[model samples]
Target: MRPPPLRRLLAALSAALATGLAVPALRPSPAATVQVLAAARDLPSGTILGPRDVRPLALPPDAVPAGALRENAVGRTLAGPMRRGEPLTDARLLTGGLLRGYGAGTVATPIRIADAGVARLLRPGDRIDVLATPSPGAPFSRTVVSSAPVVAVPRLRSDQGALIVLATDRTQAAALAAAGSSLSVTISGAPAGPPQNDGPR
Candidate 1:
């Protein structure tokens, strides 16, 4: 059948439009993610975490760190400085039995270093010798605990001396606790000497 050229052109155009409409548009599916606790802001070492300090973050399953904390981190002290969005891990908190990985019978002991400047230089994993002077006029100081590993250095307050947590046995912990405010520390690559049998009263 002979048709007008314009009418034939319009019929072809309508067929082309109908074919295009029949095909569905392609779209990619959303990726899967997992939730983990993360720091909400820049936090320094020794910060006791609270609800406002942490936030839940979604990340790819593979991107999640091993031992990442999914539960609340409240009441846990940070072992090191963490930037915003950093994931919380068990190793980062001073949890109960925080020294378990160090070895059996090791306890986390908190001690004050008389010299805040000296204590500020210490970090976790540093070996130190805790020394105590009997009096301000004392000529010499003695090592109370030698070769103790620093587990955490928490800055609690500016008005007080620096507080450091050390991994020590019961005996060393007792000596440190006894030494009280007269304590200072010396960082060492090796043991300074045998730990003194006598500690300041």
Candidate 2:
């Protein structure tokens, strides 16, 4: 027989090898599940997303075999027939809420147009400045506010044209709508040149 210390060391080595082999089998395998956005109505460009825009989606949670991408793995796009009653991982979810609010205005207080047509021509994510002339006689104009990519253009209605909705209190909304109709809301940042006067030619 070997010495006492040598025999003990051999037993320890055997135990260690056994544990190493068992570890691989004990690990859980990946599943086939992913998250997706729920069906929602058309949200305005600058509208905020509440809790209604997100829902869970389930796929074959057991279909993801070993050595495959995990169900909870980030950036992995899953495309297949999904079924109910399976667990879903929320890795690729998207929300439609802006970081800041817009369009809430105050009453009866005229919100001047800052940069005129800038708001009307903006896309969903375009940055723009809101400039308004307080009055025709006012010496210099003022920049009422500045926002990023928050304007919502009217769809399929050329007659309505583009509408500029500013972020103001309830009263300001009424005031802006009322004042904008009469005031010449000239969009700024247009090709700078002499004004084209259309007199009877």
| Whole-model lDDT, model 2 | 0.37
Cα error, candidate 1, residue 62 (Å): 30
The local distance difference test score of each candidate is 0.78, 0.37
Most lDDT-accurate candidate: 1
Clashing residue pairs in all predictions, respectively, total 0, 19
lDDT of 2 by residue, 47-121 (tens): 233444323444454653333322333322221112232232332121213214433222112222233454355
lDDT for predicted candidate 1 compared with the true structure: 0.78
The TM-score of candidate 1 is 0.48
